[model samples]
Target: MNADTRALLSEAFAIIDGIPDDAIRFGAPRSIKGPTLDDGTVCSPEGWLAQHPRFIERGLRLTEDGSAILYRGEGSASVPAALPMARALGLPLDEARRLFGQREEFTANPDNPLTDKQLWEQRVREVLGKAHSPRAEVQELAETGSLDPHFGHDVPL
Candidate 1:
C-alpha cells in the first residue's frame, strides 16, 4: 500500500481506538509474527504487517533448523477465514487486546528469532521444510543468522 493509504488507515484506527472497548468486538491492533529488526528486535504485529500489504494476505509460516531460517508467506497470505486462525497457532490474543484496548495487533507472538540462527535453521529445514532458492531473500535472511529453515525444502546436498 502507498504511504498515503497507510497513514489514512493508521489515523482511522487512532480514531477507532478512541472508542470505548465495550462498543466493539474487534478493530485495529491485531497480532501477527514478523521479521526481526536489524538490532535483533522483533517487529510488533502492527509494524510487521504494515511493513507490506502482502503480510495480511499471507500469514507467515515459521520453523527453525538451528542454523538457516526458512520462512514462507514473505509475500501473500492464505485465504481469509470467517474465524480467526492465529489462535489455532497457539497465539494468545489477549495480550494484543490488552495493549490496544479492544484493538487487534494483526500479528502474533514469537515476533522474531532472538538470535536468528542455528535452531532457526533446524526449524526451517526440519519444521517448515522450506528450501527456497539459496539466492532468495529468505535464504539471505537464513544466512544472516536471522531465520532458521525448517519447513522449507533444502537445496540438493
Candidate 2:
C-alpha cells in the first residue's frame, strides 16, 4: 500500500479501537434506536465510521449494505457496513467489504469466536504486517529492541 493508504488504515484502526463494545451492534448500519452517540444506540463498524467526527466533518454518510433495495421484501437491508470505511480510507468497496466482513465473521462464528479486542488486534497486525519491510523490521528490532514501533507499548505485537 502507498503511504497515504497506510496512514489512513492506521487512523481507521485507531478510530475502531476507541469504540466501546456495548456501542457496537452487528448486522445493521445503525440499530433501530438510531445513530445517536448515546448509550442506547448501537451501530455496526461501518455505521460507527459514518458517525465518526472526522468522517462527519468530511460529510460521510451511512447506507445499508444489503440486497433489500433490489427486491421489495425478500430480505431485510442489512448493513453494508464496509462502505463508509471504504470511502473514509479511500479503499475500494469490495476490498473494505472483504476486510471488515472477515472481522465480523471472527465474532459472529458460534463455534470459535474472537473478542472485539482480539479482532481489532488481528486486523491491526495485518495492516502493520504490510507496513514493515522484512529486512528493515529485523534491523529495527536489533537496533531498537522492538519490532513494531507504532505500538511498542500499546499493542502486544
Q: What is candidate 2's local distance difference test score?
A: 0.51
Prediction 1 global C-alpha lDDT? 0.28
lDDT of 2 by residue, 25-98 (tens): 55555654532355455655556555554555555554444221111122234535455456557777666665
In the range 1-157, model 1's lDDT, one tens digit per residue, is 3444333333323322322333222222222222332222232223323332233233432223111111243322232211122222222344223322212233244353332222222222332224422224444444664332221122111
What is the Cα-based lDDT of residue 67 in candidate 2? 22
TM-score of each: 0.21, 0.58
Q: With candidate 2 superimposed using the best TM-score fit, by how many Å does residue 129's alpha carbon deviate from the native?
A: 2.0
Cα-based lDDT at residue 35, candidate 1: 37
- Local distance difference test values of all predictions, in order: 0.28, 0.51
User: Among all windows of ten consecutive residues in candidate 2, which has the lowest summed lDDT?
Assistant: 66-75
Off by over 4 Å in 2: 32-36, 63-79, 102-104, 107-109, 128-157
Residue 104 of model 1, lDDT score = 23
